[model samples]
Target chain A: MILVTLLIGVLVLVLVIMAMGPLESLGWWSDKGAEKAAATIERLREEHARSDLRTSYSRYVVYLSGIGAIDGESRPPEEEPFVAAIRDGVPSACLVTDVFPYSVSNHGLTAQRPMSWLWRRIEQARFKNPEAMLAMLVNLRNAIQLFVSADRRYGPTYNIGTAQQVLESLLRHGYRLGSGVPVTLVGWSGGAQISLGAAWYLGLTKIPLELISIGGMMSDDYGLDRLQHVYHLRGTKDPFEKLGWVMFAGRWPIAVGSPWSRAVKENRITIYDIGPMQHNVKDHYFDPTAIAPDGRSYLQVTSDAVVALLNGTEVQVIPT
Target chain B: MGDFLGSLWRAILGVWGLDSSMAEWFRDYPHSLEISITIAMLAGVSTLLGNSVVLFLNRIRGWRFALSLVFNGVSMVALFVVQAVVIALIGFLFTGDRLTFFQAARAVMLATAPLLFGFLELAPYLGPGIARVLQVWSLLALWTVVTVVYAVGYWEALLITGIGWAVMQGLSWALARPLSALGNTIWRALSGSPTLLTAQDLLSGHQFMPVEFDFDVSAVEGGERS
Candidate 1:
């Protein structure tokens, strides 16, 4: 009798833990952040040649929060293939210091506002205090401006100015420098929102911007107009992608409908419901047959994506 | 007598890790009820210990560290007691026989004692809201313990306790930091009434800076003369 009770109790305890445990968005420290850093670094070493200008022909991948990685600290294993595809063909630089640094790598200092404006949304969501959220946003923006003004290399390098400033800056550089450069912007999770902001800004210039979003949370019309191709990937099993939790829990209208579902319905975007896989992309990250076991295979996937984007071909949507 | 023999056969299979299903065991060994019952008790005790250790580690540190040290020292002996009691209860209920209820009750108390201890340990760090939540949780837990004790005697129960300790710890770990952040933000917002920042603030990193209040005045003369 005692034994039976004990077994039942233990099983019940297990069930409770399983149900309530934090949704495995991504591994915070090791598997997500370190793994991603290693992958990016490896691609840089193998693909790009060290140029006199310290400039390499690499695309830029910007990860959005709540997509593949929540913070800069982690990238979903499923995202490894996308990054690897880019690394194989050209040297791609990852902008790790922008918004969403807390959950990214534990290495860099948190970027202030403007560089990390999306943090305001989280602050607003958690506290529902508009004033406080605004304060944080303004403070963050100022910090970014101060940081940006001090660093001249960043100004011309990434065109970090307003639309007119970007035009002037481009004219100064004769529009000849980045003419053939294929800069593919990859935004994961919440970064999908940030990518839209970037797209809106970049639309002012003639710089060819290729925007690819994996698990994007926001659907901005501005981004849609500017984007030539957008690859939105998600998994059906992913709780983060499901709108039900937010709808019931936050009691927000945004939760009532899925963003991807909407994007698909509007025909403004292409959605790829990948896999029988969960939100974590571990299954694809270490696939020896696809990417080399030692993580060499990660670049192959990135290269494939980059080549596909550059060719202006139809986006391939993979099931999450 | 037939019931006892059936339990014994089931217990032996459980101990040997041979027959996971009690129904299957009854089919195979219809005679060794006493032995089967003993096996069940032994297995229940071991499971309690194993689960308790996992729970203990979670409470102290977190899953990341627990994953590293599977055989750490902080073992929860109460887990085994709780497990034994639960198993016995299942057997008694299924067979329509009386169980060692007091023993099971005692076992459950021992298992859950650490959780109470954990609540006390983190009391200082808890804010008002968290404290309120924990207080209610602890009170309910205590009620459960007392009820269990009243229902059963200590010896026969084999007191398997300390279930859900890991779950509690995990919940605490996940909530603490984010909750703190949310609290601080709300507090600041409620207290400070500042203006929104313009694009200039974006450059400086603030929508609005707090107004400075200085009580110092140069030299106040008689009446209006300074």
Candidate 2:
């Protein structure tokens, strides 16, 4: 009777916990503020499409995925406007590449469904436990292995392999990046990995490329000198970029590659810091800084960086 | 405030089979301090947990092993085949009026969406081990997709919460096998130690000491085969 009562009590507790989860979530629910961002992206796409260029481009375009948005490529065309935006460029074919969340890097191990679930449950109980967080991160090695081998259904379903396939096919189709003209590579977060990889691939074919890393992490051996232009955007208080959170006791990727390192290196790497934004790459463009030391708005600073890169001028910012 | 009350009334009426105005649904929803804070916390916690589970599964098994990939591919192709039969069954079992195919598909998706994440969590510990590099690459891809979909727009709150919980439970169950293996390994390590177990150890099921030799001497009862 005692055993039966204990088992029943445990079952009841489990049910109660499960039932409480929805109420907690509902009480705190807010629609993800992504639609507004999408509109902005659409505008950017249109602006890029309408930009004056000397050469007529083919219908071939490159699709770069952002952080936490790798699966964007596989999503049905009808459901995603981004694909249509790229398609408008009239590229004979498109390569929708998964870029960010740095899937191939150690950072990829830190981003997974199980850890997110546990984090939510813990936070709901108003408990902030570091041990729990570390335990969740321990499975990093396993996650990396799974990504490389499994097919879409049987595994994480990331199209990392298809990236190579796309590169191969582009060659077969006679698509080539000119050495003199700067090839543009836009990336956010892990998508930056794709940008770097794509740049390297293009370099293998002797193409000169320019890379724009919005809200990206850098490595010491990133070889930024290889690119015609490199833009490193960092948010001042973005949780992901903040020293405390970015390193998170030294487990996170940013802990290893301080953005300051790029400024020190004479690799044509320009680093811009936007204050108090949460890991948003586009935050670089928002003029939100208070009391600028240089007496310029954040937007002006960003525009200047772009203009400087375009005009091939040098700016005097010393390495820390 | 009046718009809010009107929407509430319309919602109540709509539940009772009335045509409710859009104002009732949109205007009436509470945007109060208490409600907003609660909603924000809920959304934050839900996302934290949901993403945690995704991260955990990806870490343990990797993204390439996520079950959602299979289900999405299958659904993409065979959604109609599932709808025809499942919808008919649900209609017969509930209201006696058959549900439309779209309705049925929606119902199924709502019910099974959580299971997809759960399967992703379980795939790693339960299946044959995959190459580590491939696993990470795939996970990066999966993580990117999920983020984009959710980041681009606000999805149903209920769906997010449900899916998050399902994944956590499914992953826990999947890793149980690996956990058991680990437990056995620990047990063997302890048993093989040369030192005798203490009284406190006995209380903790560590009283037994390992013999100097580590051989089994059980007699063979069965006759030897020719």
Candidate 3:
């Protein structure tokens, strides 16, 4: 009975947390009022103007890191090489990696929040004791934002905020207006949902937008109608992506009227098998030591697939 | 204040039909003001936090909207009283018991305790499902009140509430056109809008249009800021 009560308490807490993101977006529990939020964007614009890299690039590649990320600037050691590979592969495109996908205001977990100390401790624990359970809190917090982005009722508000952040980041990285340069979003894991969420608002800017999901778990409800194309790079060994397919009704074959289904019917989504890579385990998608049967590292294979998609080249699919 | 909150918490548990002792506490101390406050909270929370309710609220402008809100809440309470009287009449017919209208009213008001959390109906994706669950929970609570509190047999109580519900539904169906017209008239008089925007219209209108952003390359130098 005690266990059952505890379980119920936890469930209620989770539901409360789930409701909070949308409520905050709706200005219910917002500490940062509309003026402040707008001011933040204005600050970004001013910073962009002051930046040395003001020259227009032909294309912009925005990297939205996975749920494990603490902030915009910090990248996990394991993931850094993969990002570096993408930079090397697509040197012509300006890569913007400082837009934190989990935050509506682009505020990081450690960024002056009420619970900043807790998050800081968790971030430290990830390095101090790599196997510490405290590190999972980062994933738990961000995973909730992913759901908020997928919710139809709340997605518009949350997505619009993230999209604004993405736009600001693009401008900061020298993306000239009306340059007609195609913007590619390289989203890893839960970042894929944020990318898709932001796609509709980004599309309004008249910039051609494409998505590259690297082992991303996404729901089908986010407006897929606006995206130019979706390249889902999945691994045969990864079961996490399949969880998305099973969990979301929109991803189901029966939901023919859903945006995901319509997009699939239109052949707007391309699925590529990027060899025997796991989702986020030791030999995950970005693990440089994880070698496939063809002798290329998982990082190299994933990066090459992303580069191919960015360059408008057909990516080779590895057979199961 | 602590005592009041404690009692309210117990009242919530009682309405879930979870604790018989809590149900007894509610029966012994049937505070009219407390029950009325609970009902008002239900209406106010639903108005403030419910997504669909917010859409309707958005249509209304100025201080009259608050007056209209209070009017609607009072009407809801009166409606519940009328429903209780109808249920009491039905119970009298089913069990030949002299269940007073006030007794039934109290029971009905207490049953609505579960719906105080109706604000949660604003939650995306799971909102509809949660609403249905709360409805079922309230039904069970009402049934428990009829049986355990009123001392009516379980089957007889079920028959009474069930028939009463059917009768109410029939009345609603019969009065749908007239009630809707009356509601619209009152809303128009209170709010400036003749009709509220449909959910689709509201949602579509709420889409993010980047009107502030400069799309032209030449206008980038003096881009519009919010």
Candidate 4:
């Protein structure tokens, strides 16, 4: 009886958390003005102008990290090699890795939150004890925001906010808008949904937008039509990506009219099997030590796949 | 205040057919104020949360909109009373139970307990699905009340509630024009808005415009910080 009561309490709390993102986006809690967004962009442009990399990069790659992330700058040490490989592969491409995908305001979990201390401790604990229950709170919280991005009612508002932040990051990294320079969004896990969510708003700037989902769990509803193409990199052993297929009705076979289905039919979404990598932990996609049967590490193989996509090279494709 | 809250809690549980004793209290006492308050709360919460029916209330902006919500809630009680009369008539025809108007009204009002969580209708993606679930739950509650309180046959209760709902829907469709006009008038009177914004307009997030940025970067490359 106590267990049942606890389960009910947890369910109610989850619902409340899920409702909060949309309510915030809808300007129920507090309205975040457009002026702040404009100011941010302006500041980024000025900063970019002073940088040495200005006008040097040919293509722009914005990397949106998964739910485990607390802020824009901080990343798990295990994931760093995957990022390093991308930078090595595409030396000319400006890789912007500081856009936090979870918050509609682009504020980190520890940024001005009432539960900042808890989140900060959770972030620290994630490194020391990755298996701790408290560490999973970050994932749980962000996973809800991922649903918010998929939600039609809230997606536009949340996506616009994220897109603005992405735009600021792009500007900060010397991405000249309307230069017709292709902007590729590389998202890992839940960040894939955020990438897709922001695609519509980013597309508005007329920069050629592309998405590369690295074992991403995403719904089909978030304006797939706006992206030039979607390159999904999945591991043969990963079951988490399949969760997206089951959770969202729009991804189902019967939802033939959905953007994702249409994108598949139109041959816009390209799927690649990046060896036998798991979703996260124990031989995950970015695990350097997890060597594939083909004599390549999971990180190396995944990086090669992403590089191939960026370079528009032929790869082993999975037919829909 | 404690007594009121306790009764309200019992009323909520009773509507879900959980507490028979509470259902008996509602059937016996049939407090109009309590029923009205329940309906008012349902309407107020739904409006405040920006449910599709009263999504325009979101556009009002500021705490003064609380007055508009109160107006919407009180008006819903009047509407519920009218609906209860129709339900009572249908019940009499189907079950041959000559229940008093107040008894029938109280039963119908109490059955709306499921809708007290109408704020859940604002939840993204699941909102519409949740609304449908709540509607079905309320219908089942109505059937339960007729069976337990009115002592009507289960089949008769189903027929009465189902046909009563169908008739009400048909009436609503037939009187759509006048009903819409009346709704608009009431909305305007309360909100001071000429027209209520549709759910599409409200939920589309068009009110929050995307910030525009200068796309021209050639000046920056040429050492000019424009």
Candidate 5:
């Protein structure tokens, strides 16, 4: 009889829980302003969840992800090892964070589906998703490819949307350099092109802009002429940068009459050929002060370049 | 090919009133009437010749199937048409005259429509698998028409069609085998291929695996910085 009564009580509780949503049921135990308080709490959580935005001071540091960046809170501050290096290395007065162009989750250009157990498993397993690509193409509503606020090649333009977002976040929350902050971009591999595109989309030239492409591609150099300063840092061993040139050989039309040539002549674009750096940057991240296999720390050199640019100067480059 | 097989399994279950999810297999199909008709006619002819040759040509190693179209293309189509009509009439009587012969015939045709994809059966390894799939889809299509179009009870519609189909199948087994054998014997005596094509080689699929394909598509996708 006691067991039967207990079962009945459990069933009733379950029924009550089902009849009221979990939040609303919890709210009953709280005060009159529970809903409003929840709303405010949720709002603050959203602001906090913008993990991509980190404010320092007047100088803004926008970090873009390359081809193999980890998603969400799975890793440490070094989830983005290169960005983490910049965040730790840069002055406390500068804001530093990675951007999300085509985020698979809730933020940025998201493609949400109520997944089944199998679908969820597949989602966890990172594979080439042509379905998302097709979806983006089908839903595209852009007027010009150059200004289309997206990465036309694949998923959301992580670089394009992120650059604007960093600027907006600074304006909304940063104490200094909100609208007229000097911005420094540190991009690796494909991130360099994205950073380049972001500079164009956000019109970062209006402020003091220093763009860095660390062994990145040049699919279209539409934004090369506009940035205040440009840096192309090629690692001795990285093949990804060479892939773009290999695929587009007119031959190596990117060299002749390239916008960078003019920029280079005007002392606006600097190319650094680092001898010891590989495409991965695993060796480069270890010691900021120590010299690399190339005899000097490329990381220190790149950061110093940003520092010099912020100071209205240039980093000397070994001529290509 | 897996997609086609999955659709077939769904269709088989659908005919037995298990689930009506069979249409998903052909949901993307344009349902072009002209294409469907052309395919059905082409398949009817090919099936007729293939079955006839397989059954009759090699009397020493003779085998038989439930249905054949080679020598009896007209007969088989006519028999199925008759079977559908009988099912429609029986359904009308069973359901208090709610279903008409014409409506049921239209439904039957619609049900058989996906079988036109069997046309792809000539594409080496994948053909037989896809054709087998279409046959299952055809049955499911019949169930769809009976239930959704005629508004009949799922079980009753299944029963009426099942009985008619079984009867026709029995009749074909009894009559089709002997007739095809006689035709093959006569043809062999006249102009049939002297060397028999091995049944194993003809029916069994390729032993090779599907080609492996890989792409670094996520490289193009923007995610968190790795």
Candidate 6:
């Protein structure tokens, strides 16, 4: 009995650890952050043709993926592929932060709001399409591990912790340009939530934060008012997060707070409802993925938007 | 086969109070306040009656037994209120605006199932290892309750447990001191030595019992906050 008990105890502990994922999502399971940073630095070393590589670029545009990973690698997934894409994307002049954190990496920060949003949608879809209902169930079960992610459950847990870790990593690598390193956030799917949470937190520290959310799930302001500007890009067939909007009337100001309508009106939050764009896309379809993904990979557009913001030029939010 | 074992293991753990079922049950359960009061009364009455029965079994007689009986009765009456107040304060501190007094009291009452091990006082040496292990297990159970109800982190749960215990201990010490002095005086009158006032004797004499519910602070699995 004692042996069996111990075995089960150990087994449960292991299962829990696996579910928690990567150092219990404390952001330092392995030295992945440092490893990624080194890889980015190494890539820059070869590409920039700089021998000493003593002083790298000052500014950075960090891409945080939505959900899942790219090429089955630890790196985050990129945007949809394209047709006859424009090559006028981000120039290699500015520094681009290349460490990508996957969505499953944040299984620990899965907040209830997102899951509840999905649940409400599932309930509404019950009367609609049976196929959509099945899809929703599959998505729910697949993402159930992340259902009650606990970032807000604590003062500054999980996603916020990841954001801080990312910065700490950048700072650790002598990447600090000045008192505050100018960084733009390119967040995809759930990654957008992390970016928004992080931007607000980093903003408090006087770090200049610009946000670009691609098919993000969270609809709340996430203190976006304090952010530089939030660019939200939603594709047409992105059926997942739209459920939150439709089910709860998208923005229930009474419960959480009022709609960020004024913020949207003032161009603080810009929504680009990009149709014919699914959640998944080819990588090299366009020059810029943000406004000008004529439509290529978001990597280029994200970089271009950041570069534009860095150069003090307004990147077009719509086709000119 | 492995899958079945895993599921069975989880079910067992659920019964042991590691899962959120208990917490969720309390969260969505109506009549929480009623349940909380009922549990509190149950714990209070059980402790008092259990101790009195122990004293009787030990052959405590006359004035000493009478004194112990009266003290136990009064303690029975006061335990629930004291526990509720202390647990409520700890819950407030741990959960911020998340938990209310009634919820905290309920969590505390549910959490007391582990302390029923105190009934082991009847037979002191019936698996001492089992006693210690149960206490630790109960602490985890308490953690689950706090997390589900309060939506708190494990560390926050630890703080709640620690603070709740410290406050309770402080209260017990305060309440016991006067009774201790009185017991010592009565023992002297009975020509008894201070050291000879055993736990059983004190109860039989209606004196104070400096019983403590404490464990090594370092034993809380992960690192505990100082």
In the order shown, the candidates' DockQ scores are 0.01, 0.01, 0.19, 0.25, 0.01, 0.03
Candidate 6 residues A30-143, lDDT tens each?
224334433443443353353333445445566664444221122221233211111123443243343334332333222333454654455445336433434344333323
Show where candidate 1 strays beyond 4 Å.
A1-84, A90-107, A110-182, A244-268, A281-307, A312-320, B1-226
Give the C-alpha miss distance for residue A87 in model 6, angstroms: 11
Q: Tell me the spans in candidate 2 whose CA falls farther than 4 Å from its real position.
A: A1-63, A70-175, A221-225, A242-264, A280-320, B1-226
Candidate 2: residue A61 Cα off by (Å): 8.5
Query: lDDT (0-100) at residue A31 of candidate 1?
Result: 30
DockQ of 4: 0.25
Best by TM-score: 4
Off by over 4 Å in 4: A28-30, A34-55, A316-320, B1-11, B17-26, B29-59, B185-194, B197-226
Give one digit per residue, the lDDT tens place, for model 2 in A108-190: 22246444565345433323432344433222322232222221222222222223333444434344433133445545444
Q: What is the lDDT of residue A230 in candidate 4?
A: 93
Model 5 chain A weakest lDDT span, ten residues long: A138-147
Model 3 chain A: lowest-lDDT 10 consecutive positions: A28-37
Model 3 collision count = 0
How would you class the docking of model 6? incorrect
lDDT of 4 by residue, B58-94 (tens): 3444553565455455445555676688778887786
Which 10 consecutive residues of model 6 chain A have the lowest summed lDDT? A79-88
Which 10 consecutive positions of candidate 4 chain A have the poorest summed lDDT? A28-37
Whole-model alpha-carbon lDDT for candidate 5? 0.45
Can you tell me which runs of candidate 6 are displaced by over 4 Å?
A1-23, A26-58, A70-73, A76-88, A92-151, A172-174, A177-181, A219-225, A244-250, A253-267, A281-320, B1-226
Model 6 over residues B183-210: C-alpha lDDT tens digits? Answer: 5686566534342233333322122332
CA lDDT, candidate 3, residue A243: 87
lDDT of 4 at A74: 70
